[model samples]
Target: MTDTGREEVVREEVARAEEELRAAAALLTAGIPRVAVTRAYFAVFHMARAVLYAAGYEPRTHEGVLHLLSLHFVKPGKLAVAHGRVLARLHKYRGEADYGDSFVIDEPAAAEDLVAARDLCERLRALLPDESNRRE
Candidate 1:
């Protein structure tokens, strides 16, 4: 993709990330911890994709996203290792919350996931070029 097209994709992914964070917060507030955990994970996932796209990489799977992020950003010191750990934790929680019939997430854990997602999103957003500096 051209730079402009890539930037557009980054913008869309970032927007989706923010939206998912908001939904996660709302769901937690509404007392739905399981779904909230899932939303929080997606928030981080989309932010990871945005960061990858900004760096000219496109991952086709969840594990691929994590691997690319670690290889391209975390390993190179662009992002903290904790970010990778949090993403992995959130991914695990998301899977349990979504598919594990006996798994349950408490309110506090869900809230923690939201906080972690927000932090990850902020860190990933920092890696992108400023929107105002991009050409229309």
Candidate 2:
């Protein structure tokens, strides 16, 4: 992809990230904790993809995104390791919320995931040059 194409894709990913966050909050407000947890994890996942795109990476899976986030951002000190932990935790919770037959994420756990999602999104926004700083 050309530079413009890559930039456009990254922009789309950032928008999707924000949209997922909004959806997560709405699900939480509607008392759908399990779905909210999934959305929260997606929000952070999309943000991680956006960052990876900016760094010229094309992650093909959830685990790939998490691994790349740690390799390129956390390990290199581009982003704090705590943010990577948040991604990993959210990923785990999301799996439980999505695939575990008897698992249900409580409202408190979903809320915590939402916060982590928002924080990770904010960190990515600050790191990406094309992302708006309107929320800052």
Candidate 3:
């Protein structure tokens, strides 16, 4: 795809991810632990991409989320390392919330992650003005 096409795709995906995040927050707020954790996870995923786009890298494929973060955001020394922790936790939580049959989500865990993701979003927005998600 051309540069412009790729940018559009990134924008669309970012929006989709943001919607999922909002849904996740709502689920959490409503005492829906399972669904809330799921939403918190995707919120981080999209948050990663929002940073990617602001850095002039648009992720279009499924691999693009980690791929772009690994590229630009990862090379900033300690910040990259910190993001790695976020990536690991989010990725595992994504799989756990989706596939693990006996997975039991707790309110504390859900609340903590939701707060972390919301804070992360604020930090990302500070860094990337292109982010369009609601400023939770």
Best by TM-score: 1
The residue-by-residue lDDT of candidate 1 on 43-117, one tens digit each, is 999989988998899899999999999999999999999999999999998888778888887899788878988
Candidate closest to the true structure, highest lDDT: 1
Can you write out model 3's per-residue Cα lDDT over 5-113, one digit (the tens) per residue? 6556556646766787789778887888887877776777776776676566758754677666766666664244665566667677778878888877888888887
Clash counts for all predictions: 0, 0, 0
Q: What is the C-alpha lDDT of each candidate?
A: 0.88, 0.86, 0.68
Q: What digit string (tens of lDDT, one per residue) describes model 2 on residues 1-114?
A: 777887787888888888999999999999999999889899889888888888789999999999998998999999998988999998998888778888777898778889
Identify the superior model by lDDT, candidate 1 or candidate 2: 1
Q: Write the candidate numbers in order of decreasing lDDT.
A: 1, 2, 3
Which 10 residues in a row give candidate 1 its minimum summed lDDT? Answer: 127-136
In lDDT terms, how accurate is model 2? 0.86
Badly placed stretches (over 4 Å) of model 1 are 132-136
True-vs-predicted CA distance for residue 113, candidate 3, Å: 0.2
RMSD of 3: 3.3
Predicted structure 2, TM vs. truth: 0.93
Ten-residue stretch with the least lDDT total in model 3? 127-136
